[model samples]
Target: MIIESNDERGSVNRSALRRLTGIDAASFAERHWGTTPKFTRSAELSGSFEDLMTVDAVDELISERGVRTPFVRMAKDGRLLEKNKFTGSGGFGAEITDQVDSAAVLSAFAAGNTLVLQGLHRLWPPLIAFTGELVRELGHPVQVNSYVTPAASQGFSPHYDVHDVFVVQIAGSKRWTIHSPVHRHPLNNQPWSDRRAAVERHADDSPELDIVLEPGDVLYLPRGWIHSAQALGETTVHLTIGVASFNDYDIAHHTLGALQEVEGLRAPLPAGWDPTDSEAVLPHVRRVLGDMRRALDELDRDPEALQRITERIASRYDELVRPEPVRPLRSVAQMGALRGQDSIRLRDGVIARVVRTPESAAVVLRDKTVSMPPQCADALELLLGGSPCRLDSLPGLDTDDAVVVGRRLVREGIAVMAGE
Candidate 1:
């Protein structure tokens, strides 16, 4: 769906973003996102289907990947890490080009091996960024991302996610059966990799809900829901857009992190308050909590800073984006990192560490874009999808931002940017 704003200024609108769900974002967050992601059969059809990327476009990606990186595994040990590959019950390494393009590539891979189809957010930047700009309008931080699994499946074991996800099916269909989360607001335990086993150890609730999704369908699975999916027929392709947001918990955590930087916040406790005295500590602690509350209450006070942070974070998603890797794979380690859909709130002109590139990307938050290097035709995909870039790491071009951005991108794994 083509969901741009109608203000005639070519800019995204917060109200419009809220309207996407037929409710304000705040109201949605209060009622959904955190509580439950409202599902709609026509979500993919409602707003902007016409201009979204196509199946043919995805076919080109499979072709292009051959020139860039190896088809690595996205799953391991019957468990799926965020970095592992996924495939169907048929197991991994299934060739599916017949269902995808000129020939079946899935047939070529091993039985249980499947590709990650990673970095769709960068691969199809316009669609994701458009969605992101809309989300930003509503004041919710959004992560632009993507995915396309063949018949085998780019697998992740039955598990939970770190953030909320809205998946739009672009090609074939898939089956989803989500068990209610053991803990909806799971206080992000251990690392994301460890969550799988921990979650598996928890007994699932009765009545797992199953969803059969076809092309053009969309599903919203709130974070922490224990869910599993597999390609339904032939091949399956889709886009999973994860939203990195500031929830009550997130705000408290971020505020805690911000305290290190916001000096007045770090001043020692009340002069007379004694840690040994509960009476004194009570009021002092109350005041401290109130101060923290007030600091976050001001998230929107300085609209410019709010907007800047939004832009900076939004720009982070593009840092590791590039469609095709700028360099061919010389080794498994050469594919530095895949980064994109990263997030930074660029408020107060406070520049955070995002992708540093020799070719400085003039990102337009208000307009939903980044200036790409001219020589890099795939630069847009790389920057927006989180693929590693060569201009910054390949030497001989521009400056240090390129190298820094490239290095950071390679480290993040948002996209595949292999180093020569």
Candidate 2:
């Protein structure tokens, strides 16, 4: 169950989970990852997340950022408040009617609403970096949201998330009441609302863990673990980093999808047979199942089938997570200003693959594909090998040709200049 990753230089990088939980990835994977809950104090982990978030930062985002609906939401007594309560139009030049009204947010907060800042990883700089690192570490897409609760208030009712979460307490204290899962390892399509009766019943049973989380504390809860939290005396702000991990079902789904090309599996059942009659349908079902079993066995032995599955999973990853942010204007400028002395490398967090077709060598990015002459295949490989290389040093191409290729890559968002 141990999770491991290598840097571009092939050295093992420290695991982000270990950094956050003060437990190495091997032990965490063996014991708590997708298995159980583990809570650790701030003193135990590397350090407090004061640099990541704070009360002042929250104020700035609400009052200055011109945030809109879906980004800012408020809840109280386990029910969400209407958007109209804290949202209104920006006057004159900017007329987005649903922008958050800071004054209204203050009034709502005073009335005991818990502010939920969704998608903080995309909004806040520090969280953007941290979440990206965690995604790389776990090979799972990660998202972050912040919960700012007023004293003596609860935001949501007892419920379970479909994704695993690391709850990092940043300010004040909050008491968390945790219970064992009513339905273990629920998928994205399986929500607590689907089984509310069972969740509520389990929530009422004797608690499994109940403790107050002070600033610098963290709680790791696997998916489907029922839990609820209430803010303590002072206001509370915490970040919930959700991990949408791929599982066995995903592998099987892609594998079966590849199997669709098999002729035997696609054959129709007995045309005149009564589907409702057990005697008539049982043998047909068994025969089809036997055919599918044989097809699966053949697929297991075929390397090409495994390659297709890997590509399918990689495509799914491309859809789930975004690469590092690109500055369009700056990057465009850098493209035109490329110099032989400038160092460039593949953009961090980018999902790309160098593919060779009969016609050309192409670098496939999430959003687009950049194609080059077949002569550039070796140069493309050298450029995308993870480490930064100078524009003049691209192996096959001369200085001028190397710059041309480098500029194109930068312009296409496949690579970036060093120190960016």
Candidate 3:
């Protein structure tokens, strides 16, 4: 779907999360985010998510999109059906064996299995753009998975996710029963399986909230909340927009991990002490704690340490959330056809930062860093400033040199021709 115009896209990007929750940023941060569940009706949200996905879209993805295993999965009665139940080999020249068989999917869905379309944020175009906006707004990596359940069926048993979620109901209705978390604010590594017994026990308790979600409805669920849903009366589809937030523990992990460079902290424990004996390990633990305390003090006073911590955080963010993709063929053509009079700007959704040193400036990207002479800093700054500018109008370079820089930027995927 054509989501919006450029101006509308910018406006939408800025308020994507707010639009979902029907609350301002401050209200969402103070009340709903990371603390409790929020249920908003169709009248509350800005609009429906029909543009993102639909029943027809689900059919297209299954029958025409060449979907493979893992991306297309089925579950019935809380147990995942084997891939062979819904997948088969493509015939003739295309001989991949794990592709989703539309006929099999039909049969399974008719038998009351829920169809799970995983990683739609990466596979679906509309979601790719929408998910990128959410990532930028939340500073938390976001993912989208759709659950299409047959009438009166459940996808999975009551469980919790390590990542927070905003459930956007796309079509039909699903009744959800949510209970308070047994273990709150779980980290990414802490899956519900770790506390399966507790989760199952909690499912029997009175629910904190029980509601039927219809089209245009949204439900925000913080990580570790025990919840389950069942389609009511008709086939149901909903997008699980998962947000993996960075936590204080992550900060400590990165900061302390950087302390490995300290010789004192890295020293081996006293030769042959028994690790199981508390008294034998106490002194070494005390010494290591003292060293860490001193190292932390040193790090607090060091700007370089702070910078490394920031970089590590950014690196992790980059690893989880991909920026908008560039059209390679179009970029190459634009590069070859470039001229001083052409307009160019940093590509939308490209995460870049310009860092300058005495002799050179570099644009840091996820994959590679593009370095340029210090003289190009001003030009790079203007180009990355969101607004398109005539190549010849760039500061610090002649018209021909500006063209050279423009082509280089396009070639490196840092910038694109204006209107692209």
Candidate 4:
């Protein structure tokens, strides 16, 4: 697999997405996104996920890490075990509320239960890196969960997730049975249980795909695709990378916030309105309808309003990122000692975007936005370029001005001293 960085766009190489899915990103978006299931066989898949997780890692997390209830769950015959079944008080007089009971979990596993480790991307560094790359490539929030099913055991019933998922088989093998979605492109609130009868009838009639996934295989199931898997002969461990797609509803939802600024949208309805009186409510309804149409047209024409919607969607990623811990003393001294030759780079997981206006340019970070004179636009570009650079190397700014700007960024935790 080839993974290259696109420095110009500050985006991951499109080929990386192709390599991961065995299909071009554009093609997948056009043909398969929220529409179908795809199974791609790859022997080289081990390199992509081998370091992300392992059975030993799962065992260690459950036994050592003070993992808790929701993070670690055990299920059998499609039913989840109660928290007390596999949780106990921690040592050192810790509270008994939610700590994992490793022994109980192990016992359950031995008795044919499937152990599920949720949010491994948050707990495991390797998975964090993997999921971060996916997030950058897909421009969507990515979450990871690990399913460790004992031999001849299954975790959940034949159901569908509202979000799309990439299942990577890391160890052992499992037989997967997939059926066409009963409700195509279902939203987050729509689960398979809502259409259980239709799903069951379709599943019974004929499954679209039934195959055994071995180590180094990948399966991509879009939202609403019904599927189930069971361990085959040996234990199975697979990573499910869930992608929360940004749908049209999300766009309208965010756009409505912008619409609220229009005066007509805020007018209250007439008091004591009767549902039976269409004539009484018709005027208000017609006015609001006209407002909605005008708002939509204005939003389509205004570039700034469109940009706001994009920023609103981008900000969701902020919650998934874990910022570097602030080192007050070291960071303070580093800011104070900025030299022309000192190298610096944006801190890991520090998201920054450049906003240009007629008067000035601003560098927007998660916690704050720094506005600077238009003269510093080139320097700001280099600083947010996802690469290390010395203060003296910025294109437009003089040495003194470069130092000033770099110091401000470093002081604000947006950038950090490289090689420190």
TM-score for each candidate, following the candidate numbering: 0.50, 0.92, 0.93, 0.83
lDDT of 2 by residue, 1-420 (tens): 245543232212345666678876777888899989999998898666877899999999999999888988999988999999999988998788899999999999999999999999899988887777788778888999999999988889999999999999999999999999999999999999999999999999989999999999999999999999999898999999999989999988898899789977777776788878998888887987788899889999999888989989889988999888889999998888998888899887777778998899999876788899877788888877888989887777788988999988888888899877
CA lDDT of every candidate: 0.50, 0.88, 0.88, 0.80
Among all windows of ten consecutive residues in candidate 1, which has the lowest summed lDDT?
A: 342-351
Residue pairs with clashing backbones, model 4: none
In candidate 2, residue 364 scores what lDDT?
83
Off by over 4 Å in 3: 1-14, 355-359
- List runs of model 4 lying over 4 Å from the truth: 1-19, 23-31, 44-48, 93-96, 275-287, 317-339, 353-362, 370-378, 385-387, 395-408, 417-420
Model 1 lDDT tens row, 95-202 = 432222223334433344334454444445455555545553534445544454557464565777767777776677788767777666655452345665556754
Prediction 4 TM-score vs. true:
0.83
Arranged by TM-score with the best first, the candidates are 3, 2, 4, 1
List per-candidate RMSD values in Å: 13.5, 3.1, 3.2, 4.4
Among all windows of 10 consecutive residues in model 2, the one with the lowest summed lDDT is: 5-14
What is the per-residue lDDT of model 4 for residues 275-303, given as tens digits with 9 covering 90 to 100? 68888889878978888998899899999
Residues forming the 10-long window of minimal summed lDDT in candidate 3: 1-10
CA deviation > 4 Å runs, candidate 2: 1-15, 267-285
